[model samples]
Structure formats: C-alpha cells, structure tokens
Target: TVFGLVVKDYDGDGKKDIVLGGNFYQSKPEAGIYDASYGLLLKGDGKGGFTAVKPQVSGIVIKGAVRDIKEIKAGNNKLLIVAKNNDKTEVLSFK
Candidate 1:
C-alpha cells in the first residue's frame, strides 16, 4: 500500500515531480507498523501532470516504505529524509 508521497522539483527544472514511498514486500500491513514499499518517481511536465520515472540519488536506487518524509535543507541542497517505524532513517537526495 502507498504510505507517503512528496511532490517537488527534483530536477531543478521548474517542474514539480512526485516521489512515492511504500512497501509491497509484505502483502499485508502489520498493525502499528509501516509496510515496506518501493519508491516511484514521477516527472512533471510543468503542466501539472506527471509520468512514472525511476528515481536515483547519486546513481543509487532509493526505495523504502518510509512512515515519514521530512524535507531538510542543508544550504542550497534539498533532501528527503525518510524515516521508518523503529528503524534507522535513510537520506536520499534527488539532485
């Protein structure tokens, strides 16, 4: 199941993109737990529409079922810090 989503300009092209987080590894959602899901990136065409795109951060596949997505700004950099339930967080930069 899809757990969280983020819409932002990932490519710095003035177009908003979509980053979805969720897990499908576990067929069923465990109670009080975040289900595992892969991340899917969608590129926006500046016209308020989007298309599925495989997101990569520094050529690494960024996928996980994050219970919370917190956007952190470190200087001019934009990053999505994904936090899981009782697990270590992952930092993914879509730059």
Candidate 2:
C-alpha cells in the first residue's frame, strides 16, 4: 500500500528514480496491520527497467504510515519532505 511517491533523478544518471512510502495502521482482524514496508527506492534505467535499492544504500528509510511526499528547494539544495502518521516528518537530500 503505497501512500506516497516522488519521482526525480536522485542518482544524477539522467534517469528518473522513484521513492515509495507505504504503511497502513488499520486493517481487518484477519488481515492484521500493514506495516511491513519501511520504504523503497527504485532507480530507473531509462529503458523501462527499474532496480530496487535498499534503504541502507539509499539512506532514505521512512518509518510509519506515510501520507505524502513533497519536493522543496532550500536555497542551493533540493530536498524531499516526507509526511507520516504519528511520526516525525523526514527531510532528505541526495549527495
């Protein structure tokens, strides 16, 4: 259950990358909670192919139930603002 998504060239390869945030706190009793996903980073190859990058490698781990993701420019830097439920907001920048 992806709650948030942002597409941009995070790796400076001229190809688009994807950041995914997903979590669900509510579900049926049989289904239990949907909180397994910490987040995911998908790097595109510009040929309709994508590779999943681990959070450790990407350094974009987002915990909790994500609600939204926004891109903002802070002076000379571009940043990602992640919003989640019952959790502190996360700000991210790629080096």
Candidate 3:
C-alpha cells in the first residue's frame, strides 16, 4: 500500500530510475502463513514505463518489514536509501 516513489538518474544515462520497498500478500495455506517484503530497483524505459532490475529481501523476521524509502543526494553517480525497518533504521546505497 505504499506509493510516491522517488525517481532519479543514478547511472548518468539520462533515464530516471525508481526505488521502492513494500510487501506482497501471500496466501495463508499456500505461502505457509507468511508475507514477503522486498526492496526493488526499477529502471525507467523512457516511455512512461519501468523495468525491474534489482529485487532484494527487505527483512529477516516475520514482522520486520520495509515501510518507506527516500533518496539522499550525495553528489552525482550516487544514491542513498533511507529505509525504515520494523523497529529500526537502515541505509542502503547505489553507486
């Protein structure tokens, strides 16, 4: 249920990419009573659509999950991710 993803050009290719973190509901019996949260990297196709690039696990525990993501500006060719863990804070970087 998260939105408003921040987009930027981290690779200097003139195409804006987006970072997102969220969860996908899993069926109780099929998924063994657990949900999946993921941190995703998407590259803009320059035609109003995006393609998935990187998908990583967000948390380790059952309740731990990623709530939000923000891009930190640290000069060109670098991007910082301020990820909100279940009850803590984490920082991820893309360079």
lDDT of each: 0.68, 0.88, 0.55
lDDT for residue 4 in candidate 1, whole number 0-100? 64
Q: How many clashing residue pairs are found in candidate 2?
A: 0
TM-score, prediction 3:
0.62
- Best-fitting candidate, measured by lDDT? 2
Q: Give the clash total for candidate 1.
A: 3
Candidate 2 local lDDT, 1-95, one digit each (tens)? 99899998889899998988888988898988998888888999998889999888998778899999888987867788989988899998865
lDDT of 1 by residue, 4-77 (tens): 67788877888987776765344446544444446677789998888776434423244555676767787788
**How many clashing pairs does model 3 include?**
0
**Number of the top-ranking candidate, with TM-score as the measure:** 2
Clashes of each: 3, 0, 0
Model 1: worst 10 consecutive residues (lDDT sum): 54-63
